[model samples]
Target: MNASADPLVSIVIPVYNGSNYLAEAIESALSQTYSNIEILVINDGSTDDGKTERVAQSYGSRIRYFSKENGGVASALNMGIEKMAGSFFSWLSHDDLFVSEKIVRQMDALAHAASSESICYSNYYVFTDDPADTVPISLKGVPPEHFRYWLTVENVLHGCTLLIPKAAFTTCGTFNTSLRTTQDYDLWFRMAKKFAFVHVPEMLVKARSHAHQDSHKLAGTALKECDALLSGFVAQLGIDELKAGSGQPGAVSYARVAASMRSRGFVEAGLVATKLCIKHLSGESPYTKVLALFVLTRGALMQYITKPIKGLIPPSVRSTIRQWLAGGTKKGPPGAETVRGMGLKEKFSEVYDKNIFRGSKSRSGEGSDLVQTAVIRREMPRLLRELGIKTLLDAPCGDWYWMRHMDLPVDRYIGADIVEALVAKNREEFGSEKIGFECIDLAEGELPKADLIFSRDCLVHLSFADALKIIANFKRSGATYLLTTTFTARTSNEDLGTGFWRPLNKQLSPFNFPAPMLLINEECTEGLNMFTDKCLGLWKLQDINLQ
Candidate 1:
């Protein structure tokens, strides 16, 4: 462990608030069998209960600690890098956990590729408290030539998984502090300019999924920063092309410019560029046109199909959708009288009792029942198992009967409801601890932490903004998986179709809505709208891990 002879690896960690996981990260760094390491932790003016000094003191003199007024993660990282004395440099996010072999494995890969490549990265596993979750793997066999192309489309590198030579840093430069988010991508792009980047193809880090991480809280800011970075890069590329006196623009350059403009809230500019790109490609390159068409078609479909649902959705739901679109917060109200009035509870209860509770006896007379509750009960367990989830936080978990009927692992369950009567009934039936019923309004108050948080058939009753807030709250609580249902069928003034009648035959008795009666009035035809698409979108597992 000689400081001078050993190939010192400087592990720089930039810290902000909520450093609960900092100790784990530092211990992982220290416990690395690769002893020749200098752990440099920079505290970026975190306002969280003296987390900086606490972690530093705990580490004693084993690690170097530097504290500065809040300047942002990039600034803290830059300062850390400048003060480092290691031959190789790497960064570990304050909240992220590194595996014991992380440094040694990364170092080995870098040393092996030292002559040919300047940077190296390894795969990392995503870990959450929820047992049912899958770790997403990074793409393989991505040639360095296509690295820029891949980056322009999506970020492939995880910041915590990267290891680069100090010389690489000297060449590529430190992160841009001015940029709020995507500084890592900005730095990576700069590094790619000079160095060949390679993936180690080994999982060497354990990235934590938790609430309060920068990615979840400052998603909007991050997106904005990414746009700024892209704009700068686009400008640079344009200048370089101009200086080279090349009249023909590069395809990569055009794509990057268009992408940056799109990211920076310049959709019209992006569309124009995309059209020009299509024309250019149509004449000179067919492959580019194909890619453009694929992207365009997908975008158009999403906008067109979801537009109706987006419009019809109550304001609360719309707000949530907007937040998600902005990559900000997510979550919605747990209970509202309007939502309760939807008769969803009764519908769910009846189905549960008939199929789940009574089992085959309840369906002995009926040949087959293929309804929503039956579908939910049959599919939910399979989905949960497939996702590798063992725990569930059934927020506003209406009644314990669903749990009993679903027969999921009820050992680790928290059933919350705003209605005191429902909570009392659940507690009385299932006992307080086993079902753990709580009388809390998720819409108005804080939520408990859980691995997989969900409230079935609850989104429609909430305004969009409240829904977004609920989602954001779940994310903050560090839930890795979410599964909630929303109403998507359109109610219109038209004759009941034979096919529709057969499907909803049982529920037809309760169909007394105004729209069904309005079929005789031609004037009300315009008000009829369909909400046919039920969207089930999840954050890509990789994005969750990276956060």
Candidate 2:
């Protein structure tokens, strides 16, 4: 197509501390088959090696290079938009690549779209350092009315795949610089409300995933911003009875957003968001309101009630009582005996004193303890050394049986349990200048700071509500890593009543733990005839992404 026949398309490349992949991204933009195109590189004050500036200069007049004070990705893109000479605007990240026909394909798709459609986006591929991990992602185009509702729930459109008409910004406005991570999402959400979005079925972009991406580093801030942005939009679209004559999509969307927030450890914010969801659903959707209220109450009780109850009891009595009441006692089958309607501490304390319960059947040193102890001894030292963990806290240090066998490699190690008797025994048995023991009620007491925390066979014993509180406390304690044995199975979550024993994949499902956990090693007590998939997993508190 001739230059005049085809409208000029401006590609804005926002450069940050991404010199490592800047050249590759620029080459892809410059090599596009679409002739009527201009490439603009906006340097947002990168303090990395001077390679980014030098590389831009190497392109010379072929591409326009603009530098400004360090604002952020949104600021750089806004500046580029201000100086763009093309009628259509598209953003290309410094680490993402555009196929040679990406611009041409989008323009062709735009020809078929309605005049009101101001944005055209195509399917894209996600790739990491490993080529085998690359996969194509597709999105279905929806009408403006439903698109706004979709964006409120989540961002499905990739910014790199979008080509926005210059006129769209007049009504939709430019990127919000105040937002660090959700700038693209926020802008897209706003634009979707006013303009229709057309999705091209073809995959034309390669979005790279790496460790240094802003989304990975600033997850918590991004989640808060997303919540704030969604809250504003949902509030503006009031759910008055006249407006929502039928079922209210706004209320459903808000409920989904609230659930997402809760899954990410934003418990308080999740409750507030859910309340708004319930308000919108009040007169519109009776069934939805009931479900939302149930979810909200369950989550609230888990964090507020169950968590505090666990902590109020001494650690020594905590595990013993739970085991005794649950009938997981190694002594024998618990029979029809029950410990309900009694004081938790008093009943459990009497049971512990009388040796009514030997211990949790799972932890009863019936030779299975040797296997767990050996694994801990083999793994703990290497993990501490590799992760640079200086201090360690072992919660629910159940009798300190297996711990006594492990080699303590950390600079300092502390064993803690709710059982005062167990803590005293541990201190008498192993306390030293480097090794110490404390009586800690994990569910309720203040936790000491440590580089790493090891929680084993604890969460399964508590209700799902109490487990979430303890996990939240672990994050708040400023611990870098969390090591725990998660009980996962092939089937659905097993309801142990107070807490549900989940499959490995469901680990992230309960209470939106702060970080995504890594399954470092799987230990099957199968040799001992156990029916649980007890695997040791590691979670890096620093690596949990906001989304």
Candidate 3:
């Protein structure tokens, strides 16, 4: 298209006593590479003795300036939207700056994409002082279709990064005048319903975060608005929307949404999601629901309730009491009794206490042997270097025996184990600022975001059911890669009790994992060197086939 023929992008700068940063925003807009643009400065009742006015007037007809009554930013933006002649609308907060290529890049994206979604947004940088030090906030690795649902989880979008079609305001209606702090997001939530937001995935806008910003100044009001906004968004939300948005199963998505709401201090909103979470969980089969209940509650229940109670009771009486509470556990047929009421916490503790895996009682078993770990120790560092792995989560990091010996190319190392005593020991002995330890059950507890999850020798002890939960936990953790134990030669998979020994082939039957990106064989000596096929398979968590 010719210069004039190209769609005009109207950059709207709304200011309320923002004279200090107004010039920079205006300059950034004026410096845009895309020529077909108009900069409209809407002076939102700035009371700084005409300072903001002079900034706009100094531009001297290079920009269009308009003064409005002392309404909030929403009203100012609405005025700009109504007056602009451009086909597209871009909001530029007086303190925020657009990259020179912002409009052109988004315009190019719109022209090239086959998608019908008219609203376009890109990743933005949060800056305090210099642009170089700004931290980029990238949205979830989801398609444009799920951005709306993802909005239900959390708001990571910035209004300045958006290049909304002018017609979108006409179709979805302009921003809610009543909403002061949450006006942009309220508008976004509405726009998302009518249109899928196309994420450009480029740092197009530099958003300033200062003590003077509205977010900091109006913190109390913002919290109230956030609660109401999210409550309204998630009120009548469904399983399918949450499923597609979170990329998790039905009940799991609701559970996540509930947890997210709780973290944000939106207790009422969390209760709403929690209600839906329970509603969906009730629909599951009786046994599956029971299993979910145990797995979900085990970590917290054991740690907060049982762990303290454990100290009071003798070790000999604890098992008998637990079995009694669970209606006296009877050994059912193998594979049928996959969930034995006892979870990873109890099972791993028993293994540690009894030396069931057959090493020393103080150690983590034969699996943590220096010789057994030699292959991984040698190969892992190089692989981490290649993948640029920074933060690593070694779940079920048993006793820290073999890993402590290796020099890993990692920035942060988190060793998580279900056994509380073991985690405490590891923390007291080896825990530092860089090397941390958390007591978490992979099948139940949350995993922190890391570059890689080194789950060596972890899944082999879990049943297929528990293994599925662990893998799902890995996905939910937002971690990139999973390095877990899998037997390459074992084509057939079998389900076992959680504590029992079984060769798990992640690529086979129940798991149906894709071919690993890399596999490092441990070169087995178990059962007189019988299990030579034992190896750790590596796969991107995203590529794992959940079905």
Candidate 4:
């Protein structure tokens, strides 16, 4: 096991009732351009569809199959890692796919960097079937100085896209089996504390989004886990240390939890939490006021009762309680209006105006960077330039900041979004003549053509089928280069925030595209790969001819 020897990249795929996509995920790994790879598919107690034997047999001798009673994904991953003989270890979710060059690219990057670098990851694309059709975007690279800071706030590495040296496992310990959620985030956070991180700006993986995925369900449980993890970290490392390592803690963590609950129809619990958050900000002492209010609220109390009651109190009574909750609902769900009415355009505007574009002077004297605008300004130029595109069509361009910050020629920019207000604002700022803004619904109409079709962080809300149709539409638009960012399958219950967790439909299938497709690159950003596996990368259109 000499460090200089040819490193064996062991791909550990943990499967649990993921039989449907298991073949695709395994095929994606075996198809990797990098040679000297081993596939270990650990089946974690799948009882529903006993396709484990069939799946293992399909791969023949290429994949080693291990069947164990239904332990969680983390347990299965740990089992695979323990048995892995490769110098570099990477894990892919059974439902997720990877670009052929993912391992090779990451291995090369790791070999070139200093040995002290604990982990290296590349960008990835999030594939969905959503027809609402928002563009995908990636987070800009954080300075080495800010690496620890970025990681503490969120997991910047996606497990599926991550390649960690064996040494990292020795130092960081195994994934926390007790943690049903946030295990990857916890592992990466611990890794960052001890080692430097490197980023490869390539689309190396595709995190499949579908109905049966864990992220769609168990959002509340995931949120609770994340909050516990964060609180634990704060206690162990101290809030000052966390703030020093990561940037200031924004409202996203809390906001996500609240949003998750609302989406799951836990309206009252979500609202109570939101009010508590507001109260805490408003100088409410003893914060117990919020907790007290939550306990007293009928909705919150019902939520507390439903879990145990459903399990112990019998199905007949549970159904009655559910009916009652639905019937007696007051004050609606948290962020419901925000969720229903706000499209990608509106949400982006809210995030931009309230946070990113606020023109808040940098206290650190790092330039007049708006927190939100800084990520776009620094990353867009390089990303666009790397795509070798002079022209870009920013579909559903919420605010024109992406266009504004891009260094491309004025005539090359075209912006279309559903928000008329934002579209009008864009016309006023960039002038309707130079930058074209259209009020278009990608779901219903035709899209404008361009060299590269760019979108960012816009998929999750739609169903899987709709996401695929959107991609199909993108291909039809005659765009050669497609760049987008999305969440990974590793999303935890905590990651969903307050959103009610729904398990992904087990029957949901992967998007099928013709071959000779070039998957340019993929990476994980946004603290952790909870919701989606990988983020940020350039992809070449393969199956569709953009003529």
- Write the residue-wise lDDT of candidate 3 on 256-343 in tens digits: 6765565444555766776776777966777656644454343222221122232554444443343333333323112324335566
lDDT minimum window of 10 residues, candidate 3 = 299-308
Task: Give the poorly placed runs of model 1, Cα more than 4 Å off.
Answer: 1-4, 49-51, 114-117, 129-141, 227-276, 285-298, 303-433, 436-457, 461-547
Please provide TM-scores, in order, for all candidate models, with all chains considered together.
Answer: 0.58, 0.57, 0.55, 0.47
Worst 10 residues of 4 by lDDT: 499-508
Model 3 segments beyond 4 Å from truth? 291-547
Model 1 over residues 154-241: C-alpha lDDT tens digits? 5556888888888887777888888776778888888877887877888777676543446534543544555555545444443334
Whose TM-score is higher: candidate 2's or candidate 4's?
2
Global Cα RMSD, each model: 13.9, 12.9, 17.7, 15.6
RMSD of 4: 15.6
- Residue 118, candidate 4: Cα error in Å is 2.2
Better of 3 and 4 by lDDT: 3
Give the whole-model CA lDDT for all candidates, comma-separated: 0.56, 0.66, 0.75, 0.57
Per residue, candidate 4 scores C-alpha lDDT tens digits across 95-115 of 788888898888788778765
